[model samples]
Every structure is written in structure tokens, then in C-alpha cells.
Target: MESERYIRQTILKDFGLKSQKKLTKARVLVIGVGGLGIPVLQYLNAMGVGTIGLIDNDVVSLNNLHRQVLFSEKDINKTKISVAIKKLKKQNSTSKLIGYKLYLSKKNALSIIEKYDLIVDASDNFPTRYLVNDACVILGKPFVYGALHSFEGYVSVFNHKDGPTYRCLFPNPPKSEEIPNCNEQGVLGVIPGIIGNIQALEVVKVIAGIGSPLSGELLIFNGLEQEYHKFKINSLSKNKKIEELKDTYELECSFDNSSISSDAFKELLNSSTEIQLVDVRTTEEYNDYHLKQATHLPLKSIYLNHNSLDFEKTIYFICQSGVRSLEALRFLKKEQPEATLISINGGLNEFRNYDAKH
Candidate 1:
């Protein structure tokens, strides 16, 4: 390790050379390289974390630029893992940066996480959060968790030294309709940075055995009002009883069987030219461009105006990406259980890509 590079940190009273050495020996695996993961990786790598692993299958898009500040218009369409690793290497050549260009699924979570000293749950979705929790509990590892929603964000360290796991805080995932992701709801570009930095600090504390980690306590930050709150998370024996990862981490909100690929969706359009299709995006997004013959309705409008929609017909939903469309499908499933609803997987982006290839 370059002692001069981290001299500022090494000179701290409690966090002296010993802590610096601990950081150099630590291996941390970050689950995503988007808005939150970028900051975590940057800080950890700069501070001399020995091995940093990032796993993500997503490609950079125009929308991602607003919050995932690491990527620019030039980097759009590039794989996030590759782009992040390339930039991070330039930031710190000494830190061993590893990139996994794939989504974290039940099949791979355990095998990958077992190799790391600590895991950083920088993922945006709930299923991944639960998967990280269960895997960490099973492998006897600790993980730092961070999440963002609009102007507010949450941070906590789970499964550290027999501490409370994420399941202890949330025993069950919320119903699909109860919570909307940042993609659907929207978030300030800076919120994830604030939350991510806190997560990185927690990771450092846990690794170096210095300050108190956020284990057994959840930190809530509201950027709008600039308020911070902490809630105690009581450990539950049942949560720590995981013997293995679940067969699948897709939550109740998932639209696996009910989702159609962009190519299949095109075939359906060709077969039935008059098929019902709805585009659930903001008015501005819909106004900018939309699929031909698609009815425009924002996500909240779908929830509020469900009575007007024809439940008798099989309705196909589309969004800028597929996120909001999935939310739309989930909402309608509860309101009209018998209604045949399908979300266009990968949404407009995938549809355009399909059009480009053909």
C-alpha cells in the first residue's frame, strides 16, 4: 500500500497505521454500480480497500446520468460494470477492482459473496436486498445497506457480529403496490451520494474496528427537510436461521410470467394490430416520443383512474424502461385480479433496440 497516498487518514488518533493496514487487507463486494454504488466504490478504493468487487448488468442510459453521475452521454449504452471499473482503476491503481457484469441472482449470490470479507448492499431493489441479507446471514458475513426514495434515504449495517439482519427490520417485503422504486417515484441526484457516503463510513468502521457501525440501528435521512432519524432494529432469532439462499429472490411484485419481451411484443402487435397498449410514463416523456397506438397515462393516473380502464381486454403496459410498467401491472393485479395484464420487458429502450436490429 502507498503510505503517502493515505497519510491523511493514517495520521488520525484512533485510525492510525493499524486501521490503514486493515483497510488494505479488506475485501468488499458492492452489489450495484449506479447512483449509490459509485460513491461507495470511489471512497473505499481511495481509502485503500484491497479488493473491491462490483456486480451489475445494467447499461448506462440518458436517464441514469441525472443521478448516476459517473456516466455521461458518451458512456450511454455501455455496460455499467465495465465503465465503473475502467474509471475506478484510474482513481486508484493499487486497489484490486473486480467487475462482475451480471445481475446478482440466488444462484450466484452465495458463491460470489462467500469470497468477500464484507458485502455492500448498494442495490436499488427489494429482492436483491433480501437476497443479500439471507446470503450474508447464511455465510456468517456482515453487509452495509443503503437505499434511496425521492429526497429521503436509508442506511444500516446488517449481520455484523450477530447483529440484526435486514429481515429483522422488515420481516416481509412490502406489497408490490405499497412501495414504488426511485425510477417510478423520482429522486434528487444528490440523495444517493449522501446515503452512499454514510454506508461507506459504516463499512470502514466495521472493517477497522474504530467508530460504532450502524448495526442494530437504521439511519433515515430526509434531504428535503434536512433531518436525520435513527430507529432501533431488534435482532430476531428466526431471521438468522437461514440455512441457504432462496430458490428465487423475485418478490411478489415481480412480473416474470406476465412480461413479454420486446420482440414477442412486436409479434403480438403484428398478429393483432388493434391490441390494447398503454404507456405509463410522465407526460413529458410520453410527449417526447412513444410507441404508435399506445394510450398515454402516468403511473399515478392508473391507480387513481383504474375504473376507466377496460379490464375485459388483455392490456399491455410500457414505460421509458420496464420499471413503471411492472408497477402498473402490480397495481392493476390487486385492483382487478382477473384482468389480463402484461408488462413489456425492457420497455421502450428494448423495443427501440429490437427495431434497430430488425
Candidate 2:
């Protein structure tokens, strides 16, 4: 009877009826219902995972539709967890699914984590990744971690049977500017799907105690070359015990918000009496379309041409999205400390959306 449900998986000797039973009894929590969380949630639910909890404070956006397959144009502006829950319920009515529409913080991390047997980190920010790792470590819960850049992705399972945490691999987070997010660099729709599925596989392995788990190992995938590389995570580095979870993880670590909304930019546009708009995206991106009354200043030439820009005027920086604008704003702020500067939230995408509606 169960064979029909997981016929392909049950055919494998490593994961037969015994493993399917374990999966049916497992409870898992997926944090961040973004690109990675979508596929991970779908496969786990389809595999007959008994209970699943999804946590996300963000709402779906037009840009997200390219990579986040679970959502559609209809889901735009709807809370991610709410939309995800409805879809998952339709996919599998038997699974007990829960959704948390609030952001994950230290205060509620442990409590939210306590109900689950395992956790999945699908967040893009560094602080949240660390916070999730620390909370999982303290709660003694295993977590499947995944992160993606332009065309590369990383997947690992941390704190499983005393394995190394994320910090053990990299004690310090990279400077915010050095690492560009999907908003700036752009990611292929298939990259996150591939990584998220691997994450789901690791979770199933952990739950069923079947095939070799990714614990103490990090798998890297390059979409450009379609190559996969596995490296042993340095387990002996230091397994720090997380005794307490703090309330404010963002304040302690760097978080990027270069993808601000056009509505937010419009608010600043209306409020500021004397602000100059600066567009730092590529010439082609700017030529494709841009905000009215904005000047194109490619990022590569910012240092050389910034001197020509009037320091007297308040600057409102913009880009294809918000990432380059933040970098531009930071550069201008440092060069002329007294000059007032602000980043146009969500860059041109938000601006175009607002303009089209009005």
C-alpha cells in the first residue's frame, strides 16, 4: 500500500518500507519560504513527511516568481508562509502543515524549534543563518543548510550528532559589500531548485537513517559547469555550545536590504525637497528603462566621476535593484561625510511597478 506513495524511493534498498515509516513519523521545520524553501517543502510533503512547519516574514514579489516555483503571479504581495501553506495543503491534505508569518528571532527561535524534530535554513542573510545554527545547536536539533550565489550553491547538514556549526566553518561573516545577493548578481531559476532538492534529500536521510548523510560534509554545485564537489567540513575546529539565544541578531551582524520597494523610494521622493537621483546600474539595464529624472552613473565609473556630482544636493541612489545603490550611497557618504544620501528602495523594479499602476 505504502509502495504506491513512494514507489521510486521504496525501490531503492537503502530506503524501503522501513525508511518510509520513519519519514511518515518525522516532523520538520523550514525557515525562510523563499527560493530554496519552495522545492524543499514540496518534496518533503510529497514524500509523506507527517508534519511540516514553514516560517517566513516576507511576501511574494514579481521578481521572486522567476525562481520561487511554488508561487504564481496571483501570489504577489501575499505572505509567503500563508501562500505556501495553502498550496502544500492542496498537494497533500493528509500532512499536518503549519505556517508562521513572523520573522525568526532569538526570543521565539527555541520555542518555534522545540516542536520540530529537524530544521532547514533557507534564509539568505548571514545573521539569520547564524541565529538558526545557534538555536539548532542549543535545542539539539539537526538542520539542513543551503545558500546560493550567482550560479553556485552550497548545501550542508549541521549539528547532527554533534557536528560542526556554520561558525566553525567560517568564524567571521564576509563584509556585506564583498558578497552580492541575487538581487544584484542574479541567479538562475534552476540553481536553487537543485540545491533545495539536495537539502530535502539530506533531511530524508537523517530522518530515515538510510543512506549516508551530509553531516560533517559540504557539497558545492556549480550550475555553469554542471559539476558537483564534496568536501569534508573541518569538524575538529571547535564545537561551540550555544547556551543562550539573543533577541537581536541583526544588530550584532550585517544584513543586506538593497532590494527596497519602489513605494518606499516614492515616499522618500515625496518627502525630500532637494534630492538628486543617481542610477548606478549598467548602461543596458538603464537603457532598457529607468525612473524619470534619474542620472545614469555606472558603478565601475562611480569613483572617477563622483567628483563631478554636486555634493551640495541630497543624493537618492538607485540601480536595477537596490544592491548597487547601497554601495553607491556608502561611497558618497564616506567621500562627503556631511552630504545627505538615501538609497531608493527596490530600485527601478519598484519604481516601474508604481509608475505602471498610477
Candidate 3:
């Protein structure tokens, strides 16, 4: 009976009935239901993970359907957790799937994370990623982390028996604009598919104590070049102490203050003001469908093309998500301190939602 359930995986010499049983007994928490979270959650459920918790505050969107396979066009505007729970339950009725439809914040991070055997950081932003890591560290729970850029992806396991935390690798977050998010730069749908599936595999390894987990090692994949590289994460600081998980985690991820909510800027957009609406997303994103009258100046070009902006107008930056637009706002502020600028709270996601409702 067991062999038939995990027939393919159990065939491997290292992963037999014993490992499969371990998988069934494990409880996993997947944070985020986006590109990475979808595959991770799918495989875990199929593998018969006894219980799984999914946390996401986002709703399904047309853009997410390309990569987030668990969702369909009909799922548009539905909460990610609700959709995931419904689909995953159909995939494996035996597994208990719980959905948390809220963003993971420091306030409830520890309590929510403490119950799970493992935490998967499929979160896109730095703030939440670091928050997950610090919470896992504090709770002594192992977590698998995966991040993707345009064509590249990184995967690592943190807070394992002796593994390094996310802080050890990225001791400080880079300047907001220095690193572009997947929204601004654009990601091949398959990139996260490849990386997130790998993360799910790693989670199985950790649970079964079978194959060597990615502990103390970082795996990097370049989809464009089809090259794979593994770097030894220095374990020299393994004994280092973890004191607190706070907004400081934001510093490590290089998040800037300029990132604001679209709700906060909605009033600004409605005012009888000649505001310069800047689309920091790529041309492809802008062409697909963007705010009316928004200028298509990609974030990467903003630094060198600051003169293109009309300082006289109230400048408002926007991106697929708020991340890149915030970076654009930062760049503008540095060049023209006197210029007034603001970032749409949730960027295009919020704008599109508001448009749909109205």
C-alpha cells in the first residue's frame, strides 16, 4: 500500500518506505502562495505530508497564473490561501491543509512558526524572508529559502542543526535600488518553477534525514546560461548567537523607507494635481496594461535619466509591486532632494484591484 502511494520516490535506494513514512509524519509550513510556494506546496501534499500550513495575504491575479500553476483564471481575485487549500485538499485528501490568509509579520511570527516541523520561505521580499529566518532561528525550526531574480535563482537551508542563518550570508540588505525585484526586471515563469521544486525536494530530504540537505551550502542556478554553481556557506559563524528579530531584518534585506502603500497614495492620485506617474516596471509590463498617463521609465534607467523628469510636477512612482517603485522614488530623492515624490503602496497590484472594483 505504501509503495504504491510513493512508488516513484520510494524506488530510490535512499528513499524507501522508511523515508516515505517520515514524509507522511512531517508538518510543513509554506509561506507565500506565489510562484515558489505553489510547487513547494503541491509536492509536499502529494508526498503525503501529514499537515501543511499555507500563509499568504495576496489574491490571485492574471499575471500570477503564468507561474503559479495551482491557480486558474477563475481564481482571479480569490485569496491565495483559500485557493491553495481548496486545490491541495483535492490533491491529497489525507493530508490536513490549513490556510492562513494574513501576511507573516514579526508580531505573530514566532507563535505561528513554532508549531511546524519545517518552514519554507517562499516569500519574495526581504522583510518577510528575514522575519521567517529569525523566527525559525528563535524557535529552532529548520527552513528552506529560495529567491529568484530575472533568470537566476538561489536556494539554501537555514537554522538547521549547524547551518548558517540568512543573516550570515546577507549580513546587510543592499540599497533598495541596487537589487531589482522579479516584478521590475521580469522573471521567466519556469525559473521559479525550477527553483521551488528544488526547494520542495530539499524539504523532503530534511524531513527524512536521507539525502544531504543544503545545509551550510548555497545553490545558485542561472536559467539563461543553464549553469549551476554551489558555494560553501562559511560555517565559521555557526556558533553566533541570534538575539532578536525586528525591523533590523529589513536592513539586512536592503529595504528602503520609500516603499509605501498604494492606499496611502490613492488620495494623492485623486487630487486635482498634475502628478508625474512613473512606471518603474519594464516596458513589457507597461505595455501589457498599466496606469493611464504613467511614464514608462524602467527603474534601471532612472538613475541616468533623472533629467527626463519634470521636477515641477508631483512625481509618483509605480511598479508591478511596490518594491521597484520605491527604489525609483529613492533614486529621484537622492538626485533632487527638493522634488516631491511618492510610491504607490502596493503598486500595480493594488491599482488593478481598485480598477476592477470600481
lDDT ranking, best first: 1, 3, 2
Question: Per-residue lDDT for 1-358 in model 3, tens only?
Answer: 6468789988889888888888888889999999999999999999988999999999999999889999999999999988889898999888989889898876679989988999999998877887887788888899999999898999999888978888788865566678778888888999999999999999999999977899999999999999999998865464346666653344334335544456545544564355678889887878888776577899988877777888876677888878897888877788888876767667788876554211
Task: Compose the digit string of candidate 1's lDDT tens values, residues 1-358.
Answer: 4888998989999899999999999999999998899889999988999999999999999989988877889999999988898888999899899899998877689899999999999998888898999999999999999998889999999999979999999887665567899889998888999999999999999999988899999999999899999999999999999997753455334545467767657766665677788999998888777877688889989988866578898888999788999999999999899998888888999766443211
- All candidates: CA RMSD in angstroms? 10.6, 11.1, 11.3
Query: Per-residue lDDT of 72-159 in model 2, one digit per residue for the tens?
Result: 9999999998899999999988889989989787657889998999999998887788889889888889999999999999999998
Off-target runs (Cα >4 Å) in candidate 1 are 255-358
Best by lDDT: 1
* 204: Cα error in model 2, Å: 0.5
C-alpha TM-score for every candidate: 0.72, 0.70, 0.70
Q: So what's the TM-score on candidate 3? A: 0.70
- Model 1 CA lDDT for position 297: 81
Q: Lowest lDDT 10-mer window, candidate 2? A: 251-260
Judging by TM-score against the true structure, name the best candidate: 1
* Clashing pairs for predicted structure model 2, backbone only: 260-345, 260-346
* CA lDDT scores, all candidates in order: 0.87, 0.82, 0.83
